[model samples]
Target: MTILNSQHILKNLQELKSFWQDFLPHLNDRCILLMSGDVGAGKTTSVQMIAGELGMRDVQSPSFAIHLRYENAEGKAMDHLDLYRLKDDDDLESSGFWDLFAQKNSLIIIEWANRLDFDYLPLNWQRIEVRFEKLSDTERKITTRQV
Candidate 1:
């Protein structure tokens, strides 16, 4: 079931931060954020802002590494994953993507999520899909909907 649907046109970093600050509170403790966008569409930037809000520092894209894990002082785990290089289920299996579902109190943020097959996701998981569209050099239109 859908729980939230919204869109924001952010012209600068400050506006993006403001949007995240207002939207973060509505998320569940254990949720999966599936993000889709072209290169430089602000997908990773949005994750960084959200991590900063959660007291995480130096959040970086895991494009080459595939995945990075962060834990807040409160013991909340955030898994950042980049699936841009992964081509199929075999890659996902090798990357241990399914194992993340066993973790508790986790917020999983996946970039290039359109590469993932949603049918394989556990039924109990709360998934929020976010799409980022670059409007110009400094502007992005981010749309989100829960599924």
Candidate 2:
């Protein structure tokens, strides 16, 4: 079943962390979280919150390196990927994109997912589309839906 489809007005980091705490457990084992928004829209910060919930304390945007992998104490892995540097499908393929997606027991959070071709998305895998809207300097209107 779909976990979240509502919008939240997050005014601070605590609220954001709470949001992830409330939502992360409900995510599927092989979740593909498509995070989309403009630059500095808190996409990476949201992933950081997810990582924190997953017991990965040190989290950062993988924009430069393109991908980051973390594992919790229980061995639940989380792959954080940034596709902003990829030009097209071929670029993604050449960068071992499919290999990353093949990983199991992991929640893959993709920043700048809108830049990637949606047609390549696997049909059977669980997917969530998270869109962030900057409501103010300190507030973000975040929405989620199953895909």
- On lDDT, the leading prediction is 1
lDDT of 1 at 30: 78
Superposed by TM-score, candidate 2 places the C-alpha of residue 14 at a distance from the truth, in angstroms, of 1.2
The CA lDDT at 70 in model 2 is 90
The local distance difference test score of each candidate is 0.88, 0.83
lDDT of 2 by residue, 1-147 (tens): 334777788998788889889888788788899999888778988898888777887888877778788988889888888988876777767767688767766788999888976678886678888998888887888889877
Q: Which ten residues in a row have the lowest lDDT in candidate 1?
A: 1-10
Q: List model 1 lDDT by residue over 110-147, tens digit each.
A: 99999987778876878889999999999999899976
Which ten residues in a row are the worst by lDDT in model 2? Answer: 1-10
Q: What's the TM-score of each model vs. the native?
A: 0.94, 0.91
Off by over 4 Å in 1: 1-3
